[model samples]
Target: MSLTYTYFKMRKGFGRQPMFCMVKPEMVDNIMPDEAEQKKYCLRNPVNQESQAVLSQSQQEINTTRVVLTDTGINHLEGGWPKDIHFDDEETTSRYRRRIERDESYVDAIMHLTPKFEHYIDQNNAINMYDLFYKNMPSEDPVEKPIIRINNVFRDRQCRPTSSIGWTCEEDSKLVVSYCDKVFPINTPSRNTDLVGYLWNVELPSSPVDEFLPPVACWQVVCSPVSAPILLGGLEDGRVCIFDLRSGNSPQDISPEHIAHRDPVSALLYINSRLNNEFFSASTDGVCMWWDVRNISKPTEAMIMSVFSPIVNEYDLANAQPITTLQFDKAFPTRFLCGTDTGLVVNVNRKGKSHNEVMSAVFKAHYGPVKALHRNPSISKMFITCGDWRVNVWSDEIISTPIIPGQPQKYQINDVIWAPHRASSYMSVSADGRLRYWDFLRKYREPIVISRLSQHPLLKIKAHDNGQMIAVGDKKGVMYLVQLSDILVYSGNKDKPRMIQTYERETRREHLLETKIKEIRLKLTKTEDVGVEAPPIDEITEDFTSVESEYKRIVDEEVRNMGPGRTLSSSQLEKVKQEVRKR
Candidate 1:
C-alpha cells in the first residue's frame, strides 16, 4: 500500500500576486493496500517432536585392563651339549667330535639315510628344481622406504588355504579367517572335509580363540562393522550364514538352501546399519540379495545383476553379469558397487524397482575379474581395484579411465587394501609372493616398500584397525602378521586436501578428453551419413564456355611473356603448348 498527503493554505495579498494563495489545497492524499501478513498460531498444546535416536538411556561401567610387555631369554653353550664338556680347548673338542662320529648308533643312522638323500639328489640333477619365478619384476625405489617386519606367523593344521580374512569390528587386536579348498572340480575328500573358520587374537598367537562352522566350503567372510561377535560368511554352495561367538559353533542364522543363490556365492558384506542386522550377498548366478538378520529365512529385498543394453532395448538373461565382488560405502547408504567377472564395475542404487533401473553407471575397471575393491576411508571420491596384473585407483567423477592406472606388475594382484589410518597409503599382495606398500604423499609414482613375504601366493590381506599391523593369508595355509613402519601407517599432515586436489585435477582432464571424444564421434557419424549417399548429379548438360575462356586467357598471358624482349620458363611454355594442342 502507498499513501499521499495534501494540505490547504489561506489566500494572502489577493489584490496582488499573493503567496497566501499557494496554501490552498497544495496536495491530496490517497492510500491503497496490496498485501498483508500475520503470525500463524497452533491450537494444539505442546506438540511432540519425534526423533530417530533411541529413547531409553542407560549407564554402565567399563572394565579396564593394563597391558605389559616382557622380554626373556635362555642361555646355552655354543657347541658342547654336556655340562662336563668344554669347547674352548681344540684338543678336547676334536676328541669329543671324533668319538661321536665313530659311535655305532651314528654310523648306522648315516648308512640308512644315505640312499634316501641320493634319490632326492638324483631327481634334482634331472631337472632344475628352483628357478626365478618373478622374472622382469621391477625393483622398488630405495628412498624413504618403509620396512615390513614379520611379527608372528600362525599355521593351519588342516592345510586348507585361506579364502577370506577380516579384522574384528573397529578393533586391531583380533581377526577372523575362513578356510576352504580352492581347487577346481573339487575332490570328494576336499569338499567333504570339515568346514571351519577361526577367530584369532593377537595375544594368543599360538591358537585361535574361537571357531566357526558353515554348512559347506566358505568362500568369503566379513565381520560386522557395528558388532564385534557378528560374522557373515558366503559359502560355495550359495548360502549366506552368520555366526556369533557368544553362541555355539554352528551358524546362528542361515538362508534357506532352496531360496538362496543357485550358483556359488562370491561376495558377502555387512552394511553399516543401525540394527546391525542388514547385510548383502552376491553370487555367480547374477543375483544380489539383501537380508535382515532378524528374519533371514528369506531376503527382504532381491534383484538380478544386469545392465541395460541399448542394442537389445530390454534386459536379457544373456546380458546378466556375474558379480565377483561387492562394496558398500557407509557414507553412501543408498548406493553400492559391484564387480563382475567381465571386468566391469556396476554402480547401483538399492531403492530401485528393477534390475535395469537399479544400475546407474558402469566402469570398465579391469580386463579380468576384479579381485579386491575398496573405497578410501579418508577420501571417498577415490576407490581402488585390483585385478589381472594391475591395481587401478578410480575417481567417482571420472569414468573413461582411472585417475591412477598404476603400472601393471609382473604377477597377478590377489588383494589390495587401504590403511585404516593413512589416507594416501595402501598395500597390495600379489602372486609373486611380494608385499608392495604405496604412500601417495611420499611416493605417488612407484611403491616405496616391496618385501617378499612368502614363496606361495598371498591370497588375501586385511588391515588392522590401528594401521600398524596387517594379516596376510597365503595358499600354504599360513598367515603372517606384519608390522608396518610408522611412515607407512600414519597419515601425513594435511593429506586430505592434497589428495582431493589431485583427484579433482585428474577429473577435469578426463572431462575435457570426454568432450573431445563426443565431438569426434559426432563428426564421424555425420561423415558416415554423408558417405552412405551418392554424390549429387546435374540433370542438364552444362556448356564449357567459361572454362574455354579461362584457358584462352591463360594461353594469351603465356604467349605475351614469350615476346622477343621477355621469355617464359621452359616448363611454362611446354604446358601452354600442350594445352593448345589438346584444345
Candidate 2:
C-alpha cells in the first residue's frame, strides 16, 4: 500500500469524521494523469479506498540564488547621429535641426499632433484624479486627556533617589541612572552608606544590567553619544569621576580633593575637544572646572562664578551666590551661560584677552535659585529656565525680561526639558509629583497635558534622541519609561515658521519696552532747577550717569580733604547733590 498523503492518521472519535475541502480545478488537473496513462488502468470503483485514495505529496525546499549585482556606468558624450553629422559642432547641429523641422512629414506631424495634445490637456484640466480631496480636512487636536503610556518601570534594590538619567546606544538601548541621597546636607547619611549607580538595558528592564561605584555619592551622570561603556558624572562631594561599564564597579578616574569644588557639583556637560574627553562641571562652590577624562588630577581651565565671585571679605565667601546650573552651545564655543543661586543668568565670554573686559551680561531671572537652563535646540538664542514656582521662556536679545513669562505653578518646578522634536513645546516635572507637557504653539499661558506619573517628587526627566521615549525619575529611585503621543514629538510644516514669528513679535515688544523704560528713567531723573547748575544733563533726561559721576567726584574730594577736626559740609556739595537730586 502506497502511504503518500497530506492528511494525518485517523485517530479516535473526532478524527474519524470525514474531512471536506474544495479542490481547485487546476489542482485536480495537476493530480490527474494524462489520457495515455489513464487508458492503461481501469478502476472498477470510482470511489475512495486506502491505497487508491492516497494523495501525492512532496516538500521542495526553495533554493535561493546568490545574485551578485554589479553596477556599471555608460558615459556618452552626445546623442546618436548620422556619420555625416558632428554632434559637437554647433553650426552642423543647427543645420540638421532646421532641415528636420522643414521636412514635410515633420510639419504635418506637428500640425496634426495639436488636437490630440489639446484633448488630453483639456481632460487633465477638467478633473485631476491625483488631486487630494481631503486636503482641507480639519486636523484633530491632541487628546484633552494625557496619552502618555508607561512602557517600563525599573526599581532600585537599595532605594536611592534617581539623580540623573542618560541614554546611549549599545547592543541594546542603554541607560545610566545615578542613584544617591539627594537630600544630602539636610539629612546627612553616614560614610558607610552605599552609593552604587546602575546601568540599565531598556530591553531587559527588570533589573540593572551593570553597576558602577563612585568614590563619592554621584549626583549627576551623562553617557557619551558615541561610547556605550564610558560614563562621566559629578559626585556629591564636588569631585568629578568617570566610569566604564566594561570594568568592575570602581570609577576609572576621579578628581583630586585638593582641587575639587568646595561644594557638590550641580551640573555637568561635555565640551567638544580633539580627544572628545573634555567636559565642564558647575558646582555650588561658585566655581566651574573643565576636565579631561584621561587626566582628571587637575582641571584644564577654571572660572569663578563671576556673578557673586568677588570676595570683599571672609563674609562674602560664606554668603557668596553659587553657580547652580550651566548651558553651553557648541556653535558658540567662546561663550557659555550659567545660572546663579541668586537667580542671575550670566553669559560668560571666554574670548576676551583682558581680565576686566566686560565678561558677562547678567539678567535677573527668578526669585529663587535657578534649577535648570535648557537651550532651545532649534532656536539658538532662546532657552527656558525653571526655578522657584515658574518656568519662563527667554531670548538672548531681551536682557530685561523673558520673552514668555509663564505664571507660577502650584508647586516649585524641579526639572524642565524641551521636547527633542517640537520647537514650541517643552516638559516640566514639579515637586507635587505631576508632569506637565507644554505646547506653546497651542497655548502659551498653561500646559496642554498634565499627567501625574509618580506619587514621589520627580527629580529629572530626559527624552530619547528619537523623541519617541521619555524616561522620568522620581525621588524614590523609580524610573518610569514613557511613550509619547505623535503630536507631542512631531510638528506641522508651519510650526517652525510660526514659532519664529512668535519669538520675533515678542522680541519687538521687548525692544519697545526697553525704550520706554529708558524714557521713564530719563523722566524720573529730571530736575526742576535748570539754570542753577554745573552744566547738568537734560533738565528732563532719564540717564543719571553724569549726576552719579559728579556725586562720586564730590564725595571722593570730601573724603580726601578730611582733617583732624574738620566735618563734611553740604553747602557746595548740597548744590551738586540737589542738581543730581543728587536727580
Candidate 3:
C-alpha cells in the first residue's frame, strides 16, 4: 500500500488503540489537537478516565511553561537575523551561516495573532534614576592622612638582656629598662640609629650581702609622675629599691623598718596621677599594699586575700594569696583592682575603715593566674583581664560575667591594653607569639588584625599617648616598634567618627541602665519575704524606670535626626523601644 494511505489509516485508528500507539510514526503529527478535542478524547478513553479519577481523588497538578524573549533575540528577528548577532562564538557563527546558506529558519514558531492598534513606542528610550544620580552626585572626600612609617629601631647593647615585664617610656622619650642584675635608663635618639646611650644605671639591691644573693632580678619598675627623676623597682628578693636619677649612682635599699612585703613583687602601679607620692604594689604573697614615697617601711593600707572567708588576724600573717597585677580606676581614685595568681580579681576600696575591710568584692576572672589587669583609659568602669588561655572585658557595675568574653583555649594571653585614642578598640598579645587588634563594635568573635611577630611569646605591649605608635616586647629580649595606619589610629572622617563616638557613648549608657534595672529587680524579688515596706527602694525603682525611658527616647531621637535614609522604619523603631523598655 502507498505511504499516504497507510498514514491516513493509522490516524483514523489512533483514538481507538491503546495509549502506547500514540508514539508510532504514523500516529504522530506536527500539529497538536485543540483543547476541546483533547478534553473529549480524554473523557472517552478508559485509561485517560482512570487518570482523571485519580487526579480528582487528589489536587490536580498544574504544569506551566513560560517562554521569555530577550531584547537581543527580538532585535535579531526584526533585523533579518544579521551576522553581527552570530559573532558571539565561532561555532554559533558557523551554524548560523550554514542555516542561512541552506535557506532554513534559525528558530521555528507557530503564530496565533490577535489584531490590535499599533503605536510607535521606542522600547530603548527608558530612563534610569541610578544613572542620573551617578551623573549629578558629588564624590566623597578623603580623610586626614596618618603617619604609619616605622620611625626607628633601637637595638643597642645586646649583651644587656632586657625583661619584657619591666619597661616604660618616659615623658622625655627616654626608655627605662630593667634587667637581671641592674636597672638602666636609655635616651632614645631622634633619628634612626642603633646606638642607645645610657643616661643612668643602678645595681639592683639585695640584703644580707651573701655570695649567693639570687642575682637580684628586677621584676617590675615604674617612674614617679610628680618626681620624674625618681624610679621604683620591684625586686626578686621581696624588696623595692628606690633610685634617684639625679644622684647618678646605685639605688638605695628600703630600710628594714619600712619593708612591707614578704614575697616577690610581681606588679607595681602609681595609685593616682595627681598623687605621685602614693603607689600600690602586689606581691606573690597575695597582698596589695599601698605605700607612700616618704614611708616605704609599712603600707598605710593593705588588701589581703586568703583561701578562707572571715580571715582572722593570724591568717593575715600566715596565709597570703599571690597577687600578679594591680590597676587603679582613673575616675575613682580610691578604688583599685588586683589580680591574683589563683585566678581571682579582688576589687579593693581604700576608703574602708580598716585594712582587712578593703576588699569590697572578688571575682573568679580566669582559669589560671591573672597575668594582667588594664582599665579602659576612656571608660573608668570598664576593664580588661588576661590570663592562662583567655582574655575578657568586665564592667565594675556587673561583676558576675564579662561583657566581651574570649574563646581561644590553646594559647594563653600574656598582655592586653585598651587603645589610647579609641574607646571601643584594644590590642592583645598571646603566648603563641601573635598580636591581635580588636574593635568590639565591629567584630566580637574575631580580631581585626593578627600579626605573627616571632617564635618567642610577647610578654609586654604599650601604646603611645599620641595614638600613632606602639611597642611590643617578647621573651627573647627583642622589642618591636610599630606605627599604626591612619584608619586604625585616628577616628576616620567627620561623619564616621561622630557615628562611632555616638554609638560607643549610647552603648555604655544602655549597659549602665540595664545594670541598674537588674539591681532593682533583684532587690524587689529578694525583699518579697521580708515583710518590711521600704519607700526609698520603691522611689529608686521609679527613678530608674524614668531614666531608662529617657535613655530610649534619646536613642530614638538620635536615630531620627540622622535623617530618613539612615534611620530605621517606624515599626522597627517601635520594636527597639519596646525591647529597651522591657530591659
Candidate 4:
C-alpha cells in the first residue's frame, strides 16, 4: 500500500477503530484504568473479530522484530551501553562515552551473540567451569617469619627507698643529685635511660656532740673550677662542708667557730679563677664572707650588707639584708655584683683595702628577693635577674630602669642561664615545668623551643662551661642531665657569630679606656690639692734613670730562671730577635 493512502485510511477510520495496533505484554497491566467502575466496564465489553485480528497481527510483528548486532555495536559494547541510546545532548553523550571507555576493563568476561536459549545454557556452563578451576588450584607453601618483642628495662627495675625514681644516661654526661642527706653522681647518656645507676655517693655525717639536732641537708653544691675532684657544699646549719672525691672519706665540716654564717648558707661561688682555693659564701644572716680553702678555720674577709645612703654617707646596720646571689665581671675582675633578700643589688669593688673602704652603688631591682643572677659572657655590662615571677636584664650604666623590661604576670622564672657560646640565646626553667630557649636577637617575646619536664618544679640549674650540657635539680631531689643537641648549642649562620664577636671586642675596649680615664682623673685630683710644681731638669733626668732601673729589674726577675749566661740561649735569642723585629 502507498504510505499516503494508508495514512488517509487510518485518519478516516480514527473514530471507529485502528487498522493495526501494537502492544507489549508488559504494558497490559498499566493500560487498564485504575478506577474500579471504568475497569469493570472495559472488561465487560468485547472487541469484534476484525479488530481482534488486527491487534493480534500487530503484537506478533512486534515480538518478531529483528535486532541485528554489527561490528560497530560489538566494539562499542566494550565501552558499556551506547551513549546515544539514553543521552540526548551531543556534548553530554560524548563526555559519558569518554568516562565509560576510561573505566571499562579489558579483562572483563566476553559476551557472545547467540540465540536466547543457547546463550542461557552457555552462561551456566561457563560458571560451572570457573568453580571447578577455583576448587582444584594448587596451594602455595606458608612462609615463616620471626616475631619481635620489645621490653622496657627502666620501668621494670626496682627503685631505692630514698630515690623513688631515678634516670641515668651515660658516663660521658655526668650529673650530680642531692637528696635528703646525701649527694651522688649519676651518668646519663640519653633521655631514655633509667636513672638507677650511682657511680658514687656520700652521706652527711651526724653531729658528734649534739645528737638531738636534725641532720643538716646539703642546700647547694658547686664543683671547683680548678680541681676536678674537689666540691664545695653549703649546709642548712649555717656551716660549709668540703668534699674531696679523691680522698673517698667523709665530708669535713669547717670549724664551729669559723662557721660561714649564722643562718642557712644559701649560695656559694668560686671567687677567683686564678686562686682556686678562695671561694665566697652568702647566707640568710645578712653577711657574705670570703674564705680560703687552705685555711677554713677563719674567713679572710667578711662584708656585712647594710642599707647605705650615698648622699648622707650614713649606714643602717639595724636592718641588714641577706645576700642571695653573687657574680663577678670577667673583664673587670675587681668589680662584682651582690643580690640581696631586700630586692636590692650592690655593685662593689673588691680591690679596696677593707670592707668599710669598698665603693658600692645600690639599686632596688625586683619586687622580691633576687633568687638568681647571671652575667652575659660576651657583654660585661649586661646581666639578668630573676625574682618575683619576672626576669629582667640590666645595664651597668643605667640603674634606674632595665634594658629588657620583664613581662608582667607572665612566668615565674625559677632559674635562667645564658648560652656560653651564643650572645643572644638563653635558657630558663619556669615553675610550670617548662624549659624554654629564647633568642633575644630574633624574637624577644617568643621562644624557640619549650620542653615540658616532670611535675616537680626545678629548683636549681647549672650549665657546663663548655656549653654542651645542663643540669637541673627538682624539688623531689631528682636530677635531670640534658645534653644540648648541636643545633641548640651552635649557630650555623655565619653573620651572627661575627657580629657578636665584633660587638664584644668594641665594648671591652671602650670599658678599658673609660677605666683608664677615671684613674687619670683621680691622680690629677690628688696632685691638685698638693700644689706640686714641675721638677728641675736635673731631677727629671735622675727620676728617669730610676724608672729605667725599675723596668730592668722586672725584666731580670722574669727571666732569672734561665741558664746562667751573659747572653740568652739559642731559643731565647730567637724569641728576642722576633720581639726586636716587631718593635
- Report how far off residue 361 is in candidate 2 (Å): 1.2
Q: What TM-score would you give candidate 1 relative to the actual structure?
A: 0.64
Q: Which candidate, 2 or 3, has the higher TM-score? A: 2
* TM-scores for candidates 1 onward, in order: 0.64, 0.65, 0.54, 0.50
How well is each residue in 1-583 modelled by candidate 2, as lDDT tens digits?
9878686654574555678999766643445558997799886867866665678899888879988999999999788889999988999999999999989999999999999999999999999899998999987765544478888889887777888889976556777898877554636654327888888887777878888888778888988756888999898888988888787789888888999988888889988666778789988877778888779999988776555444321233454458888998887787888888889888777666443333457788999999989889889899899999989999988999998998988888999999999889999999888888998888788888888899999988998988878999998889988888787788778999999999999999999999999998776566433433445467535356666777898777776777556656768667657766724
Model 1 pairs in collision: 4-29, 6-27, 8-25, 9-23, 9-24, 12-20
RMSD of candidate 3 to the truth, in angstroms, is 25.3
In candidate 1, what residue range of length 10 has the lowest lDDT sum?
534-543
lDDT of each: 0.82, 0.82, 0.65, 0.61
As a whole number from 0 to 100, the lDDT of residue 502 in candidate 4 is 48
lDDT of 4 by residue, 1-583 (tens): 5556433355665586647778666644556556876556645356555444453443333466688977653344333446455544668778776776665462232222346668799889868654556667886634432121111011112222112111123333234433432232125222222222222221111111111111355555666666555666666567776766566534654636455577667678776667768888887677777888877877787766764623212334455678878886668777778899888887877666544445456767898989788888866677888888878777676556566766753657777888887777788877776677777665667777777654766566667666766665555544555667655676545636664564455456656766888899899888878998657799999977876666565447547766466555578656654554454
Per-candidate clashes, comma-separated:
6, 4, 2, 8
lDDT of 3 by residue, 232-290 (tens): 87765566667775764356446242455676678888766555688778787766667
Superior by lDDT: candidate 1 or candidate 3: 1
Task: Point out the worst 10-residue segment of candidate 3 by lDDT.
Answer: 205-214
